[model samples]
Target chain A: MAIKEGIRTGGRSARVQASVHAAVRELLKEQDRASLTVPQIAARAGVTPSTIYRRWGELAALLADVAVERVLPDVAPLDTGELRADLRAWTEQYLDEITSEPGRNLMRDVLSSACPGYCTNILRGQLQVILDRAQARGEALPDIERLLDLLVAPTVYRTLFAEAPPTLEQLYSLLDLALPGQDPATLCHCDHRRR
Target chain B: MAIKEGIRTGGRSARVQASVHAAVRELLKEQDRASLTVPQIAARAGVTPSTIYRRWGELAALLADVAVERVLPDVAPLDTGELRADLRAWTEQYLDEITSEPGRNLMRDVLSSACPGYCTNILRGQLQVILDRAQARGEALPDIERLLDLLVAPTVYRTLFAEAPPTLEQLYSLLDLALPGQDPATLCHCDHRRR
Candidate 1:
């Protein structure tokens, strides 16, 4: 999907877009992000500064557009035929990807961008797909917001801010909490009284 | 506590620290952050540039220091003689402050800083105090990590990224999910299959 609606996506426009995105990716690997400028990016992409500005508005917007494309899942979440298992697999894979070096950088770009909601919507859409499949199978599930609050939020928060990302087992426990009738107690091994 | 360990906190040092921090806060209100330079801050604070460089090391470090001070809780979370009530009250107040304009700006500053974990630790410390008090009352409660994963993480994540900060009622449901023996289904009014 286009990062911004109403943008033309025909042949030449698409070619310029790909070249500019590739330039951004290459330059990010080569230099500090704060040093990246539209003129510099345009020069590297073999396009004029006006073209870059006309298409993407500014450097932050350009970076955000690239980040959204990088982060959007290329395939639907795997169907495990069970809601909990499906959620577990999806979340674990998400955690792994986001905690990687490039993933973390993309996350910062998206968050720092003017349109952070694009990335948020992408994530919410993925979870909604999982929840919808579960419902189709006659399985009871918590609402999408519940999953966002308990599952996606924590995973992203820990990945970005904590000393380390949540473990696979911790991801399972969070999924347990979000799914109906799953006893989170059985999955939790820590003593409640221990501070 | 000092933002960096071993920094002197008495007399001239304290005065310089206050002045420099005040300068940053003032400049942030007065001008675009990307255009702000250490020399300008030092000029405004009436301190030499070397002094700022010596103490804070750089602008991001200085900004992180100021953000931590701004975001840290000024008082203990109020006690309501019950674990759930206490958590709910504390979280509601936390949400209010973080979602406000100044709070939102401070959250961005902290997240963008070089030492994000300082702010993270401050938040964790506050939650630990609440959990400790609940434990003292002989109330069964989840561990500190559980609180971070289920409550604090989502609160921070949504405040920073979502379309709007979560509502007090939504905060209540999350607290319900975190506390032992509390049925989240009872508090969540939305239909699970609706989405």
Candidate 2:
């Protein structure tokens, strides 16, 4: 079943997916998300409701598919020549995006889906790019797993469940903790405490 | 509505809730979860299905309520006199419980429910007890929010989504990170790494 789906991801199927996703994005921006229905989405996408049902299973699954696409980083994280600067830049931008209202909704949709690994891998890949850049520059590399555990996990957990999102200072502190002895002063321009 | 529910918790309503929850727990152990229904649960508890629905709203919510009860730390975390030992003992026990098969299922039920905050607060409260104990001992207290972000968040994220649950060593390492300058050698008996 998985292979069959994989085989059909081109030409007509790909076009249908792209249009359907675009329609969902536009509709989500313009209307209340709770009011969205399959038929409305199909009409907007120039497809029948049956087409959506046959391809994506249901509204929740379809939303998850679109969310998975949106959350996946389309490009490498920005390179700032220094490891601390690069990590700060990438992490700050990441924190900003995921904690936004739309990003939180996307997170919920993706989590509700059967597959969360797709989004997890996208995040890990982006972090890996930054780590690789640091290594290439002969800077001491921070452990990726540590970064995930200490930084990404907290950021995500707080975003999803905590009363409020973590601040920029909190993010910098986490980065400092994750990469001990890395000079927190050089990590960010903000006047947060340096451990 | 909330006030009404609170007022009703003392008499027949409480008994019905107790019996239903007990029935659900028993049935879950004896049968496949997907096959069990409200009718079966109601029959086992000697109550009508309508009673279960009226009180709990639905099967998912009922399951979540039961899970929330199960996961709440019934007693204070062990006080081993020292701050590091107390943290290790509490966190290790927590990790062992929540990463088990039944624990994972309970986590899913709680998260799927409308009020994840109930479970989140329970966890935070448990950690706060550990921290408060440390403070009374004149031990420098680790920030509770930092502990939640660094320790609880990663433990949960890994339990819910990662390919594998984090190991005892990983938990120790996180504890070490969250409370830096604390002697890692004394944190856990296992020889993972000091730094």
Candidate 3:
């Protein structure tokens, strides 16, 4: 292959790896996740098939890694003093992505895979990476990770695969019930503001 | 269909519709949302192809209606005194449903669908039915309805459809951020919360 060779780890290598990474990202954007083949990656990267395969076992693995990498930085979530603001920001970013052609296409192919384990594994890994980051920052309340999952899981399920939007109003409503830091006793009560 | 044609409501004819409904519900219990079809539904009901299409338009519509109907009272959600307790109860129920054959199957199929609008309609309708009833009883927090879409949508998407399950920790945390009712400034963030 004429494009590049070997994993470049040094300062110069960073540029090469960046190129490879960019190629991978570009492939994902252009092709359906299901249709992605090593030949294509190699052709696009100007690298050998062995290089792509050696670097990543399969397309799903590569896509999973790339998805985690590319998606997080832009939409990784902001946790200011308030959870709602942070989440709204998070939701807005995700909304843009999922509704986008590339994101929607990528998710559809990924979720439609026959192997349930793979689907679960990639999504779990991607989520954990972001959630762990949020938690480490002290922005996460107890069960904040669960909040992230609950808030998001249903919307996607209802939308991408189920093929419905499930009303933004109701979705946001559920989010209010689910976000973080509120005392359960108060939430449970009719009067509510005992604080 | 002849099992109770003469009788109405609780009799044999009604029993058959009941059986069809039950079978549909049970099938949802046992399969992934990804692996559904009219033949499958018919087989599950021990009925013929004509019986299904004659009665229902398509697999999506039938499943949508059946799944929606079953989502209501068949599995009671949390109405306990404390919000956290109720949330825990609800989460527990969701966990049970998802883990069950029908729950997993139905969810998988629903989330796997490509038509976002259609899925949205079904889930929105289902959520509305559930929330409306809860609201009428005055147990539901006013703002929670609006956020409900954000909260539950993501969970479904994240779990069977997205990359991971919303960890129990996330769920608990989200409830806290949500339930306390917003401050005056925060109140303006959402238009529907005024009720």
Best by TM-score: 1
Candidate 2, A1-195: lDDT as tens digits:
011121125699789888999999999999987899999999999999999988877787787767656664466788999888888888888788788776777766765666545456667778888888888988877788888886777777777766566788898888876774455343322223332
Q: Tell me the spans in candidate 3 whose CA falls farther than 4 Å from its real position.
A: A1-36, A64-93, A112-158, A161-195, B1-50, B60-84, B99-104, B114-147, B161-164, B167-169, B177-195
Q: What is the C-alpha lDDT of each candidate?
A: 0.76, 0.73, 0.52
Against the native chain B, each candidate's TM-score is 0.71, 0.69, 0.52
- Per-residue error for B194 in candidate 3, Å, reads 28
Model 1: TM-score, first chain = 0.71
DockQ (Cα-based) for each candidate: 0.31, 0.20, 0.23
Comparison by TM-score, 1 against 3, better one? 1
User: Whole-model lDDT for model 1 versus the true structure?
Assistant: 0.76
> Which candidate wins on DockQ?
1
Writing each residue's lDDT as its tens digit, candidate 2 over B112-170 gives 66654555666777788888888887887777888887777888777765656688889
Q: Model 1, range B67-169, lDDT digits (tens) per residue?
A: 6667554577788888888888888878877877777777667667665566567677777778889889888877778888877787888877776678888
> What C-alpha lDDT, on a 0 to 100 scale, does residue A163 get in candidate 3?
39
Q: What is the TM-score of chain A alone in each candidate?
A: 0.71, 0.67, 0.60
The runs of at least 3 residues in candidate 1 whose Cα sits more than 4 Å from the true structure, single-residue gaps closed, are A1-62, A184-195, B1-59, B183-195
Candidate 1 residue-wise lDDT at A127: 82
Question: What is candidate 2's CA lDDT for residue A79?
Answer: 91
